[model samples]
Target: MTIAEDRAVELQEQIRLPRSMRLRLTRNGLTLVPITQAHWTTQRRIASQIEERLPGWTAVGEFSVIPPREGYSPEPDVSAVPSDQVLPDASKFQEDLLRFVVEVVSPESEERDYSTKSDHYALRGIEAYLVVNVLTARWTLLTRPQGGTYRHAVTGDFGEKIEIPVEDQTLVLDSSQFMRV
Candidate 1:
């Protein structure tokens, strides 16, 4: 391997990985998720919906979710880093840091968000991972990952709602408008 490749690999090893994603060294610099305009639009809607409801709870837009020993935010989907060492500086996070990660599935990103990320997140013990599929107009909620995969997942169609738990707290994710997809 090239010296640069070896150095990057070493850096990944030194960093902590969250449950939902992985820190990969690629020619593209780094890749977290496949993000798109449709995904962003739906994500904004979901965020707005949360802001309108949920008491004592903060609905952050692309904010951090601090995992175990470090903190890192995935592209457009989620962020989680451990707080013991504090924020940002603990940089470089993968899937496990997140309590939850939401993906508004676009055709371009659907496969990655649903299968690839789902498997990675489960292995790291991320509590919940949501896929709001714009194409199908359905929201897929996956939980209870065992043996590195989510064994339980419920697909709530548009207009249907799903209740999710975070940090041992339950919060409702409304899919009322999403059902129209």
Candidate 2:
């Protein structure tokens, strides 16, 4: 492993993060960001919408997701996985089981949400990745992962509708009431 990867593993194994914070392995190494109230609210709102639209799919918040890439573990603000796919008895969810991942952009995590996490999720072949920016009240939906990047992207301001195709069905998320910081 490279120095950054080794450090990421060490940090993951050793660090005791508080409930209000989450750690991520980025290109720069291990990084921590505090979860603000607005962030939590936005996450919950999105998750609720997903659950309402996609029955039988489990939408969880702040769960660890282990991508195929080594030394990269990201806890998306919200993740949707198959409810029937029995997961291992561990804290991390394998990327193969993840149908969708959502990241709410905080002031300190704008770049990571828009770039770093997007690249990582695409590389892992996640079907859909949504980025909600509370600062600007805008959202971006990325899909069609190819060659370690998203082949299609759609961006719009909050209050616009985002239609995400998952498991042969389309999840229509109404961002009209999504919380903004």
The global C-alpha lDDT for each of the candidates, from Candidate 1 onward, is 0.60, 0.83
TM-scores, all candidates, are: 0.63, 0.87
TM-score of 2: 0.87
Worst 10 residues of 1 by lDDT: 64-73
Count: clashes, candidate 2: 0
lDDT of 1 by residue, 43-64 (tens): 7777766555545443444533
The weakest ten consecutive residues by lDDT in model 2 span 62-71
Model 2 CA deviation exceeding 4 Å by range: 1-18, 67-70, 86-90
